[model samples]
Target: MALTKKGEFWYGTTSGDTQAELRSYSVANEHEASRFAASKCDCGCRTFALQSDEDAGVAIRTCTDCGQEHLMGDSADHLDDAAPETHECVCENEVFELMSGVSVTPGTHDVRWYYIGCRCVECNLVAVFADWPCDAGDAAAFLAKV
Candidate 1:
């Protein structure tokens, strides 16, 4: 029998849109990588892993091995978990900036990137966000106390 490659692995760009640790290929196959991408972001911007190669470099949430990609980040109103996910995004766009609001999602942790709003040519959109807190309790307190 030929050696059977019976597993899933994923590879991705080392560059992230957020300030969190730039996640590279974590597993041996594609399946796991897709899972990792869907599990929210460090900056609360949600993730959907992509596979980029030299030819088709940097497609969104796309897997080069399986040719399957996920294109997300249009909406900004869901919390899947409390892992304190943050967002890394492009500096320029047509609409809003930041991820969420400090009021709705207080700046609890030091390990997050507060969306300071963006300078779109036509409009500057301000969003809200939060992620894994450098001080989880302090963040929670700030959210609760005020």
Candidate 2:
């Protein structure tokens, strides 16, 4: 089947006195380069952040059908602010906020990559991070951090 969003995506809900909504996200910022795939929903239906190539101080995200881009004033890709290129992967210690830990194999060590963990502060063990393109040194530096 196609990867098009058709059904009503459960953005959030209202329980007791709580309400939630869908959020767009980005993998980079203006000072930094962009990463990951755009125009797709994050893992599960949760509040996702967005990044952009503009200087509105607001993040940008495009709608799948209409192709209309939306602005998010609160989201950001602060990797440049704190996380440098060295912490770009798992094999290192970059798995603090949005990752568990980096992994490598003795066999396919030359052809492997790392995965991200989670960024949610309220829920522990809740991973919604995606695969970020990285290299060996990046992973090594990450490991050195821890």
Candidate 3:
């Protein structure tokens, strides 16, 4: 199946209604998207702040309530291997909502690019943390893994 918009979130921009599109090739809706984003923190908080580095293919999720960070997604191993520094919002808060976008081949639906974004819950700042080229035959599975 082709990727579809599952949710919408503000991306801290004045351009194009200041919103970013969240698309999933597998998940069906916003609620499912939330579940796929991350699991509940040990502190019992389901919310988190997210950051990613495409160069390393690493995505980190920090618990909003307790500030515990977790390496997540299919590329998590890459992040673990690199051991690069993590990110923190300027407000010193570690809460964020996630959004995603993708580009695909016209007919084959092969994912050509993937982007992950986060909106800081505290300051409402939005950033595109990870975006990279993809050449997956199964777009849905690729997205789910990410």
Candidate 4:
């Protein structure tokens, strides 16, 4: 079975089955909604259990197979969680350099590239493309902007 997202809900489907199983969460965020929906999954292969503490502003999900616990939610404001790390993005266009930073040590190089966000320009979205290693030339360009 595979889980695919459509709008706000994550729909689950099995290979041989023609029917799709559906689930949704009362929460707002897509990630949170997906996790919530995971709990409702019918597949017996993957099992999820949630442990929540409202007063502490924290919730965790445990995977029975891997024994790993993942944070489900925190009482913290949603702004930081949904806010984009970078404001400049090219949307569906080619990636354009917005800003970058770098640190060099003997044999080690640490580079951070801040690309434009993925949303359309008119949307006035604040997000960034995934960060990437800044090559020397790109690093030079990014540094000039900084």
Quick one: best TM-score, which candidate?
Answer: 3
Q: What is the lDDT of residue 91 in candidate 1?
A: 40
| Candidate 4 accuracy as lDDT | 0.27
* Model 3 lDDT tens row, 36-84: 2324567777567666676766676777788887765455547555544
Candidate no. 3 TM-score: 0.55
TM-score (all chains, Cα) for each model:
0.18, 0.26, 0.55, 0.23
lDDT of each: 0.22, 0.27, 0.53, 0.27
Task: Give the C-alpha lDDT of model 3.
Answer: 0.53
Candidate ranking (TM-score, best to worst):
3, 2, 4, 1
Query: How would you encode candidate 1's per-residue C-alpha lDDT over 1-146 as one tens digit per residue?
Result: 11122233111222122111111111111111111122223334422322112121111232223434332221112223212222332343322222111212232242121111121212221221222211222333332211
Estimate, for each residue in 20-63, the C-alpha lDDT of model 4 and write its tens digit: 12111111112111110122122232333333333332333344
Instruction: Give the poorly placed runs of model 2, Cα more than 4 Å off.
Output: 1-96, 107-111, 123-125, 137-140
User: Judged by TM-score relative to the true structure, which candidate is superior, 2 or 3?
Assistant: 3
Off by over 4 Å in 4: 1-45, 74-146
Put down candidate 2 lDDT per residue, 116-143, tens digits, no spaces. 3233222222322333333333434433
Q: What's the C-alpha lDDT at position 140 in model 4?
A: 39
Which of candidates 1 and 4 is the stronger one according to TM-score?
4
Off by over 4 Å in 1: 1-59, 75-104, 107-146
How many residue pairs clash (N, CA or C atoms closer than 3 angstroms) in each of the candidate models, in the order given? 31, 14, 0, 4
lDDT minimum window of 10 residues, candidate 3:
26-35
Residue 10 lDDT (model 1): 18
Model 4: how far residue 49 lies from native, Å: 2.4
Q: Poorest 10 consecutive residues of model 2 by lDDT?
A: 14-23
